[model samples]
Target: MFDWPLLRGPVPSVVVILGAVSCIYLLAARGRRGWWSRTVPIVVMIGVIVSVIADKVIDHVLYSASVPVEVLAWIGFGAGAIALGVARAWRATWWQRGVVVVTVLVVVAMAANSVNRYYGEFPTFRAALGLPAAGEVAFKSVSAVVEQPQLPVSGRALDQDWTPTVRPPAKGVVTQVYIPGKVSRFTVTRRAYIYLPPAYSDPRRPLLPVLVLLHGIPGSPSDWLTAGGLAATMDRFAAAHRGLAPVVVMPDATGSLLGDPMCMDSRLGNSASYLAVDVPMWIRRHLQVDDDSRRWAIAGLSYGGTCAWQLALRRPATYPTFIDLSGEVEPSLATRAQTIRVAFNGNAAAYTRATPLHMLAAAPHPSVAGIIGLGRADTTFGPQQRLVYAACRHAGIDVRLLVLPGAHTWQVWSVGLRRSLPWLAYRLGITAP
Candidate 1:
């Protein structure tokens, strides 16, 4: 069943306004006769209440099911319900007629506002709805880029339909594995996609090292498969460098509000356990992977980059190579004393304990290797890379910082991954042909 509660912010507003207006018009037409008028309003209100409750229950149930099927089923249910409701209220009284007209006008106005949101051209009506100003601005900025139109050009279709030719993985297999986390009771279960290298089928070869890939805030494992194009790049690299390719595991890391957990054990949930414990366990149990720390690496973009450092620092025994692609490290004690104290319940020491910088104060793990990449134009993350580089240098850890050309977007990360893969493969004892 569709979980209406899972619908985005605008969807609920649309449903509530339309549903309430429909109920009001129905009552007005029925003339409030006998207890019918009073009873109908109460019943309609009750129905609304019941629908919300049912939505939550359904959401919980669906989340536990297979992820792909659950998404499709929920969408289908939501569409059917909306259609039924609209059809039932199509014919109505004078007040109902007036409501229909007003609703149409309101929808028109909202559509205009959506256009503005798409262009980043105007302030959204969300402020009128009482959303925070900063949230509104962020929402507008993100939405504008997402909603922008792409030119109708494809690799193979210049004169035909404007369909982009998406190249499939040459010899990789993409499989979704669900690992139940403690937070799954309240939120979506953690999802991980394992991408096997081209040589995975070869029986005589040693198992390839695994690179745990993480996505940024508001993104899922599918982001790498769809946007990052890691599989295609890895395929090409493998073909060039013998038959060896590193297995990549993309896991959802946004178990907390900060999106990327920085791979720390969060007080809000067991996100760190989900990533560090559950994910590795799942990989080892299900796939043919190298068991040694020297064969395991971790890399991520943006928030994932932050997580890469945290995971490596916290559990150096598990991951040997850490790749930070334009990622910022949590501020050091001297730099973030006040901010840490405020953010972590006035516990500066606790903050330091949880931070990657603090963990690196001890001698670097001999098994662990670190690579930091940043774009020159990415002023925000460049300095962060430098900080991590400096700390690793001071600790006498084997770390390399590469300043590439680009900004904070996927373009930089994609290029960084291509460059970093060869080094990672070499360290992991995988020979490129």
Candidate 2:
């Protein structure tokens, strides 16, 4: 089960509580004034507080559980009812009424957007608010799952050359296994999913490369299976290549930031250690993979993008290649230094040191290869990629940057991943047959 308390932190809870209290006080005091003058502000405030809190709570719960779209929609209906009631009861002039109506609509729209962020389908009210349709909801939903803290470290290595337990069957076979980890125990076991490639089935193919595929914030391992269609994608590629596919591993990247792990080791959790060490160690012991640093690739979208860079830079001996799609590089220490304090355990210097852009400047890793893809329309794409590209160039590291057309949507990341695969394979020496 997902943790609801994780979503509504003290910050949001305090804000909601204060809003509610203020609304009640204003409404009660307004009774002394004219009905129209006092009732309007009082009812509007009450409506705003109720609608916002109810919607936020529902969104928090729905996102945590990966609940269905219909369930979120039902919650939206209840929230909308409260909003409508307040709007109707607000005794105000035409302009005031318009303002209240607009505010209510905006709140409803935000709630709908939150639901779409988790449920993989936009509610009807989203279209009414001029929001994007629900084509990429699955990716968003899966991202949420991968970011959840249900999975944590297992203190195992993922570089074993071959293990019967995690290997694929010879010819036509598929198996599923669950191994619990130390950090979150049962929660981690239930959420972690590992996939061994076809090469694992053949004894001739020893030391197969591994690709630690990460999902963005609010995403999970299931997103690659459902939204990314990675299994089918790998199957087709492998078939065409005469049976060569990289072992793909996906893990939840959320736990600290936004109830989603920023993929960093923080006060919220030990996600960084879980991904960089535990996941790889587990795969090594259970699967047939090349344990060497040169054969490993780490990549992710959004916050996962940030994680990919952080992991590769920090553990260059473990991951030599990194793919970042529309990820934000942590800002320089001089600016937003406090962010590191908040996100990385109150250690600004450590945060700056761990940042890929900064680390590459001090000590260059020759074996490491990097690819950064950014959407032209994404607000952070160009600037973020520029920082990464500049750092790689300064370090004389091999890197590629591609700017494509699109927004911060999964469609862009999916297309980017597909396009980058051949290059990545070539760099890793993963040829057909």
Candidate 3:
């Protein structure tokens, strides 16, 4: 049951790879004769049983993740059919290898339905063969390719009947950037991504809003661009609205590619400061956007979603609207003691003081709006999200809790973004409130 969702995204790749391997095995098995025919069936049956046991052991004792067995089960089922076909071909004088091909194709065709349901149509099919996808744009560095836009103290205003400096906008241009860490002074570290909608260069461009999109703990800024389909989604919105979209700054909050950062200014790094101060400061200095807090939103998923809530409450004046897509209730480790030990160097009081739930309790309730979007099947985070939503309502803050269809996977996140982006646009004044 747990493995059913995993099959949705990975089955197509499995089919392609499994089908290829089956073709090769079909040729090899065709040359076999008498005694070997019977042994092949016995061997395949044994192999299937052994593999299942091994997978269970690895899932329970070795790996940390709850490894799904559905995909592997499909592979075994296909392999078993091929093995039976091989046995039959060798037994008869007229060795027809078509049986193996038919069985493999049938199994694969059934699995193909689940593709793009989770990973969101990866850029290339070659990736199914375990090859690096070509045309992979690492990060779009806008500052290096184009000159930085400098806004006056007032800000960039709308142009009457203004046309875009760069016209015929398709999807937004994603450029990798090195946003200066002038305030936090954290490493200029990993590259961040900036998305310029078609309307950015438009002469009639209104003061565009800004959304700081954050990824999960064990993830990169590129996760949003690649797996989350940020480019495609934004492009659709931009194409509809004549290139008018938020100046999307996908800043790297987690300094390391795989570290949690917890959105805290701790021994790990000044990640909270980086997001709240450095990234925003750099965006204002370098990009043309509405400088108003009302026009700014900080949004994230998983770890980044937790960061969004933390940043919103801590710097309520800077970002009043935060979209938490499947975020935790507070900054967490395996245990409270462990969190205190690691983050604040054994200072339990500091850990409690810095937690988002604690901070939200102490802070004054300002007129703010929040979106708590969680996947309906995601049991771990959904309950906590409800608590946070309730807290927001009790505090006189406006909040909407949406339980979308999907588990904790890209399928859910894609929906989360699709739902949140319009609201984000509406709040930031890109669309009418």
Candidate 4:
């Protein structure tokens, strides 16, 4: 039951149905008194109003990123709030109070299920509990397997003669490690996750390419491993090519869980420096991987996707190749003026110069290549992505845009990453170009 899938199958449907039934009972169970009936309606109305106002505040004022939470989630929230009110206020029989308690639980579950369905972030109950999935271990324990090899003079791809001397692990291993913000001095402490492909288990420890995966706002590094299916995808890719896949590193771009650094160097945080400099330096020193900038690729979904664009543009030599999934054209916070005020500390000139369009128009990038993926139903970011695609072309970037199904959800992102793997593998030199 712990690993039971939460997003799909009959589980969510059953929960929704239960919530509906509970709501109906709560609505019909008002006492025979006229005042009780009037009071029940009043409380329910208040609950609905409160939920709507809160949603507006979160979506319109607090966050610039359009959250994927649907109206169904707000309905559930209202119902749960009403149930709690009834349980506390109604002077009723013990059975009625017990029913209200059950209703509260069911409605809360419904709201969570509805929200989770939108993002598809937590697919299983185990993941919802924030537990590491199977085959995950602490980083310190896996250090023995990582061997330091002689740094190459020129960039090198996987050698044709390289073969596993020992039986490689069937799947890659995921490890959680704290990458210190030594240079950037990023204060918020968060651990980065590493994915060592099956090839890394070999005694020779073939130095593989690295792919840095970034997560969206209101998320953590674990988002990629859990909803993004990092390990399983890499394992399948490696199995097809004699245990060869890039070592994927998922780092914390934002200092806090909900903090929006906008992937820039300013008052919010030195997220740009952390990602561009600190992360690369950490990868080189701690992990036995290729140092060639050409072999490194960066990818992200939404906020992370926007950051990927910024990194590739700001430091082309470091991340020449990138995959952006449903990212905004530019970093934002409610409004352009507010974004500049918060992220750049009222430095509108710096903010304007930092946007993707501004950076692309200012300079040409002939060596950079990128893949832009957007959902067919995503009317919001789809146009933004199209604009970015045009700008990239004008700036001499080798870029492709893919319109997949689903809107600003993990459905698009997971598939986008999977579809881009063949091209990514070829570009990263995991497979022959």
What do the candidate models score in CA lDDT, each in turn? 0.59, 0.58, 0.69, 0.82
Predicted structure 4, TM vs. truth: 0.92
TM-score of 1: 0.58
Residue-wise C-alpha lDDT for candidate 2, range 80-182, written one tens digit per residue: 4355446454566677566555555544444444444433321133322433222222222222111211111133222222233334433222233443445
Off by over 4 Å in 3: 1-168
Give the C-alpha miss distance for residue 218 in model 3, angstroms. Answer: 2.0
Model 4: per-residue lDDT, tens digit, 1-433?
8678899998998999998886676666544565455655666666676667666776777665444446544653666456554655467778767767877778777877888888788988878898887888778766764444433334344645467777878898999888888899886568889999988777777778889999997789989888877888889988888888999999988977888888888888788899999999989887888778898999999999999988999999999999999899999887888888888889899999988888898988887999999999887888998888888987889999989999988899999999999999888876665
* Candidate 2 to truth, TM: 0.60
Scored by lDDT, the top model is 4
lDDT of 1 by residue, 335-414 (tens): 35544544465776777788887788855666668789898777667887899899878877788988887666566777
Question: TM-score: which candidate is best?
Answer: 4
User: In candidate 3, what residue range of length 10 has the lowest lDDT sum?
Assistant: 152-161
Could you tell which candidate, 3 or 4, scores higher by TM-score? Answer: 4
The pairs that clash in candidate 1 are 241-432, 241-433, 242-432, 242-433
Candidate 2 runs further than 4 Å off: 1-190, 202-206, 255-261, 331-338, 343-345
* lDDT per residue (tens digit) for residues 212-296 in model 3: 9998856677677766768778888877766777888898878776666678888767888888998888887777677887778
TM-score of every candidate relative to the true structure:
0.58, 0.60, 0.72, 0.92
| Candidate 4 Cα outliers beyond 4 Å, as residue runs | 34-44, 67-69, 72-77, 80-89, 145-159
